[model samples]
Target: MTGLLVHSARLITANSPGDIRDDPTGWVRIRDGIVTATGTMEGWAPDGDEVVDASQIGGPGAIITSGLVDIHNHGGATFAFDGSIEEILQAVDAHAAHGVTRIVLSLVSAPPRALEAQLTRIAAARGEQPGILGAHLEGPYIDSDRCGAHDPAALHPPEAHELARLLATGVVQQVTLAPELTGGIEAVRQIVAAGSVAAIGHTGADAGTTLRAIDAGASLLTHTFNAMPPVHHRVPGPIGAAAADDRMILEIIADGSHVDRTIVRMLFAAAPGRVALVSDAMAAAAASDGEYLLGAQKVTVRDGLATLHGTSVLAGSTLTLDRALRNVVSWGIPLGAAIASATVVPARAIQRDDLGRLEVGCRGDLVIWDSALVPRAVWRDGVRIVADAVAHNRPLAAG
Candidate 1:
């Protein structure tokens, strides 16, 4: 197998807090789709079949980090997750072009039979691309009043039989629910028992009930402060409970529309490493803004803001992870924290250790960005998938 070496770039390892090792001259070696070694340029010896001098491509401030991971996304490229396999693949490609290499296909609230079909199709889609992590069911068992883009007519109280059926597919990595519903706490327990993450989302659950759900094994808060109640000093809600708990990982949209810039900074301060930046993006992401469908709801997207056809409620977002990364950084977040929130943080939120870090034995998936933080090249499994003209011409092969 051909070994590849990438040298002369800032590396955000994301293995731990304050772990950014390489500032402007570092190297990483990949063999057979796995990172075999990484270090400063001084320790590097040129012994690879393929070599890339990142500095030549992205100038003096080139940055290389593990490929961004999106844990929650409906679809992109004018395709919804409930669409056919071809549409799903197209959506995945659109996000990948924007530096999201690993993604959990999110589905909105729908009937049991429909959801089962979607899950099964997503499982098949995962087979087509190694980047498709799995499926994330974001509804059906959530609060109707809090169902942002999910169909209110499809909302249902959590039931053991239905939950068991969905988890039985073994392809579901996470399930978001309103823990305040009947049997909701037990549902959290059941999801955990089935090796699936139970996420508290789309709910009117008070802080007390939200904490109870967390204790019952709910470890993720989906799209924090969006579908749930706000934090009131007298009546704290799920966002407040999640912020106080170290075990909970809060998912933030970071699109500047779904979440305010100040609140985005505050969540990072409150939860620190617990904040997972996700693009709760719908079909309009990476495409022109117009009318779109989110599950059964009619959505109209105007100037990149998506809302219900006739109302002001946000349906989803026309956001990509790369933009989310830049948004947080522009909002005064530390560079390391912003990168981790887009990469390792979301990977850990879904319990994926093989992704989100450029460590030895991790997948050789990374993004090379110019000084402006825009991705100039993307690599997945040791193969460059997307690259600009400069990146294509800058590979300095060393024998």
Candidate 2:
């Protein structure tokens, strides 16, 4: 485990530092927990304490890339992130097997006290759990009319005192709130000032309001096209504004049911590397179909698509990042572009440069995939998390 050589891969290289692309037959070397070197076998040899033959597992279709970074996730394995610390890491482990090596745990809107508890606990555990990047406060500051799957009663406008308490916890990485509400732009300003990425979501904003929020430092759009108003010829909502602004990063579900493949392609064409493929995944991500709760509202999962129990309002998703990569590729995007969406794009969105790359001095977190892009192995911080990727791909026990 001291040093390992992983070569003969579809070596994914960053096209120009941040624009990631793929080249056939890639190789990487890991010394300790840092990426020591990476390149193809033009004039080199494969030698290490333990040599991993990528071709031995999947013939000529072996693809290796930086592990997917999920900047938005609720929970998986039927365990909600709002639970205790033990449950949170368990849920993260479930997604880890599917190539989601890092995560920003997202919490749905809740009461002020409950949110404070969640934030404090997560902040305290941030350093202890390397997989957890931070907590995303998908808030009580949303537009009630568009509160998809969130309890309307729990949804409220932003307050200075509440924002102060949450920010003081020091674990807030991003906050998703409706920008059309009263003081919405000001809230965006506050969030950005406190060093957290402000995001616009569940809003009834027109293009003008969306632009103002962007001007006010709102740099991200959460789960585009689901809770917000749809694009129109006259009243283009946040989606149009995001498309217009190159600085804004948009998050897409890419579960095929939440957004159509045609729209996904259009989004890629519209934004290029600005799209951060996020799994706004819920409790049933890697588990069997059953009853789950996305925040206080009950959710039902039948055939891996989660929604409000009696209604058609889609509640998060049961998708993993690897599946998202596959879904995007199915939409005809190049493999490099798709990988960028899942890796560097999301890392840049969160401003974590240390992740989502295979360069020297970067953390040795990478995923080895088979011919179809399904993960066959996963490593985090130079440590193997999944002993056998094929075994984890099987149907997991329902939590």
Candidate 3:
């Protein structure tokens, strides 16, 4: 049995909710793409076909964490998920370079036929690539007035037949819909029945309506406070409603533009162990700034801020999970908590408990970070993907 061992660095991971463990001198062992054991260096014995000494690789504050999992992402590297399989792979590789090991390909609002076609392609592609977790439908059933960068013309009320057809594709892991539509609550139930996550997003639903969706089994709040209404002391909108519930995992786009970082900190406090940081990125992510397409809308990304071509409405984001991890840590979030938000929290949000943590039986996916929180190396399925930084000169100063 081939194995790989990494030791002599900090191991920060959450085994269960509020059960984060941070070991100063820890190690993890992987065999055949699955973590086989983990503990402090004291228990280490001779093992593994290959070994890495983390202290020699990453400087003083080197840390090892599970590979980041992004549940809400449209596209990156000048390619959108709505394109052909080749383009989708290109986007996946682009994010992989930035340390995202597992990701859900998000598709913006489009006609039912177009969405179905894209979903079918993703289903086929998932077989060829284990990293392609599945698809997240950000909508065709949402409020037009709150449609951020989605084409209002492409929006529609949820139809049971239409949803059944989409879920039948078997690749739709999550569906984001406005739960206040004519049949919204039933749609939530139907989505839950199909074994998919029903998330409330791109909606104008107030607290009462949002609570009803929660009752019907909607477990996620999509990019809280972006396209939806703000938290008013009087109204306590969807953000307010979802924050109060322990069952709901609130998705936050921590990029500086989408929501204020100060507000993001508040959300973490409001919903401890319940927030999942996501890169709601479009094609502009990991690519040079320029014109891009998010669904049917034209977007212009300048200085890394993406928005509708002629309007101030944010299209998606230019964030990657690695950068998101750094952003929150800079905002006073403890490193362990921030890492959980990017990894374990998102995986649990979609019911994929096996993908995001460092434990026996979890996938062998992780990132090695320097003291500055910059990823120095990435490994997936017990194989090194990024080149080892130890082979180079002493680490360069992080910006």
Candidate 4:
């Protein structure tokens, strides 16, 4: 890669309140695929390499935010996770065009043999793609009652040997399981011990059981309200427990179907900076209304709503993080808070300190949006990956 110089842009750091420093005429320098320096136009000048004038692309009101980090997603475009390696690459490229720079490929519940084979393939393909972060196993050990679209036959208690083997692959970055299931609490400890984040999801655990799981080291609540039991005056399920815990990070799918707008607002108010907006999208994302396969089950997409072919249960979302950000802001969330949920909070959830901020020494992953908050250009690791060059290199396929 080569050096890059970005000039004349409004930078939104999403770091602190004072971090949104305006620069009618400022410049940011990148060298060796990292942000080196940023300052006003008078203090910095481009010496070599490529120079990008942000104003020329999106004009004065252009908004610049950190490249989004989606830690959980099953598929996008027409590619499903269960497909071949070529299909995975196609999915990664599809999401990259939408300003997602880092993504954890979330896999639904599957048999041990199938899951291991998929993990091995993903491990082999790491670093070959720009934004393929790692794998997120969201299954095989969860409550059968809350399985949602996952195949219930594959649900079982987490085994120590099986989990050790999955972690040993070095490709699994996050795992979601129900704590109330057999051996579930022990599984949380084992997953945490392997340096991977253990998330609580697809669960039927009550408040006490949820608290115990948190005490055991599960730090994430996957898709907060969709798979878990609903909050009631007497029950106060996992959602309530997560709300009361300060150390937990809650994931919300803001597709407007999986969660109510009012409920999303309440979660934002309750969690403050701890909520991370995730897509939880499957193969239907960025694709048209049609039939699609999620793991072993079939789903039908209608008006962007995906559901199991014949059931009322929602399968997953067809949302992208950029659209989710827009939805939150549309629901009266502050732009800064909404941006933080999509960027900083998710980055923090995965314990990635270097990303989700535009400070010096951080990776130069950024997106420039027009006044309407539509992406105009996206950059990953100081490299301009989206523009006329990108369009020519890889034209987007029609959804």
Candidate 5:
């Protein structure tokens, strides 16, 4: 049986909720693409056919954590996920460079036929690529007032035919729509019944409507506070309603642009263990500043911020999980907690417990980094995707 071992590394992982064991000097063994054993420096043994000496790679402060799982992302190649299989693979390689081992490909607003076509393509790729976690439709049923980068014309009430077709594909794992739409709450109920996550976002719904959706089994809030009404002292909006609901999983983009660092920390405190940091990245991610297409919408990327062309409306983002972890740590959050937000938190949000964390039964996906939070190597399904850092000399530099 082929095996690999990582020894003398700082393992930043949690055995369970509230049981984070950020071991300083730890070792983990992987056999047949699953973690088989783990321990600290006490009585380490070289069992892997291959070994990674974290100390030699980056010396002390070398940290290892379960690979990040991005639950919301449009695309990352120069092109978007709304492309061919090869383009999707390009995006996968792009984000993998930034330590994202698992991803739920996001699709922007489009006609039902268009979205369904894209979804079918992504569904096929999901089977081909273990890293792809299926599709997340972020539009076609969103509130026009807060559509963000989505096309207002494409936004409409969730129809049963469209909903039924999507569920039949068995490709959609999540749907983001305004609960105030006609039949929205009923759609939420049906979405949950069909084994898909119902999320509220791009919404102008009031607190009451938001809570009703939660009662109807809507469990996630998309990019909290981005396209939704904020917490008003008089009328608490979706953000307020979700903040008070323990059953809601809040998706926060920690890129420091979509959300401020201070507010992100406040949300982390407000939601406790229920917050999942998502990139919401578009095609410009892992690339230089340029223009890109996001679901027939033109977007400009400059200085890492993606916004609509000829307008100030912020588009998705150019964020990657690695940069998100660095941003939070720089804000004074503990490294272990920050790491969990990018890793385990998002995994659990998507109900993929088999992907995150370093345990005997979990997938052998992880990132090796330094004290500065720079990813040196990334492994997906026990295969080293990022063999080495070409920019190792520029370690710890903020993007």
Candidate 6:
């Protein structure tokens, strides 16, 4: 890869608490798809390759942060997870423009045959799309009573053979199930043993069952507080279990409607660095409000509220990670904490140590945003993918 230089950036390193550093006259050097050096303008000058003027691109308010990582998202830009390769790529491109550099394609509840076909297709597309990290299976093993927005008829207990087949496709990275279901805790162990993340969600699992799953290697809570039982004084649910366990990562949909701002603040305070903000968004995101398909179900999105055609249950979110970040910040969360939820927390949840930070030896995926926290430019693997001067004035994407 060729080398490039980024100068005059307000750097927010999502490394530690209070690590926001502003060097109005600073610069970063990129070589071989890694950040080689960073420092102030005093002794910094482009020597080997391109010397791009970042201020000219993004103006004075250019803020540089790690590329956003979304470990769970069903679809975006009118593309559902069950679509063909071309449609998936189009969805990914739409999300890339919004600064989502890495994403795990989440699949809702479906039959074994349909699930297998989708996984096989996604596995085939893996090499062609670098941002397509892996697949998240969020179905086939959940509570029938709490299966909000999911086809309850498709719910079933985890079968080792079925899971083996999905894992054999080499595209299943994360699977969400209810621990209280038949064979659910054992399924968590099986998923972990297969080298994929196991998560608990869409269930009526009580605190005891939830913790047991965590002990059995279920490391994530899929969209906490949405489909699971609410936390009650007498009966603390999965949300409480996740909050109490430091090893578990909780996924929060911060679209302001799925969760309340006060609860968001509480979760940030309770979980600190373990919360990952996700856009559990469906096909309507980044597209106009209308009818969209998620798996076999039909959803209607009106005024940004997505719901199943005949039910009051929230279908999914219309949120993007940038909007989630903004909402968290608006809820009085510290900028660093909110940013970490969208970056480091999700990266760590997926066991990707090389992403979610702006530092030496890390993948050169990044986002440059203006003062309003709007994405100006995006980079993936040192390649420039999206650069909108009027929208995202920054130059270059990644390589």
Tens-digit per-residue lDDT, 326-379, candidate 1: 888989999989998888888888888889999999999988888888788888
Q: Cα deviation in Å at residue 374, candidate 5?
A: 1.0
lDDT of 5 by residue, 282-303 (tens): 9987777888888988898777
Model 1: residues with Cα > 4 Å off, grouped in runs:
17-22, 389-399
**Candidate 2 lowest-lDDT run of ten:** 390-399
Model 3 Cα shift for residue 276 (angstroms) = 0.4
Residue 138 error, candidate 2, Å: 1.0
TM-score list, all predictions: 0.95, 0.94, 0.96, 0.93, 0.95, 0.94
> Which residue pairs collide in model 5, if any?
none
* lDDT winner, 1 or 5: 1
Better of 4 and 6 by TM-score: 6
lDDT string, candidate 2, 19-77, tens digits:
56566887778778788888875534655446787777646788888888999899998
Model 3 Cα lDDT, one tens digit per residue, 197-296: 9999999999999999999999999999888999999999999999999999999988777877899899999998999999998998888788999988
Least well predicted 10-residue stretch by lDDT in candidate 6:
390-399
Superposed model 6: Cα runs more than 4 Å off: 16-25, 41-43, 389-399
Model 3 clash pairs?
A: none
Maximum-lDDT candidate: 3
Q: Which stretches of candidate 2 lie over 4 Å from their true place?
A: 15-18, 42-49, 391-399
The whole-model lDDT of each prediction reads 0.87, 0.84, 0.89, 0.83, 0.84, 0.83
Question: Cα RMSD (Å) between model 3 and the true structure?
Answer: 3.2
Clashing pairs in 4: none
> What RMSD, rounded to one decimal, does every model reach?
5.3, 2.9, 3.2, 3.6, 2.3, 4.2
- The deviation in Å at residue 275 for candidate 3 is 0.6
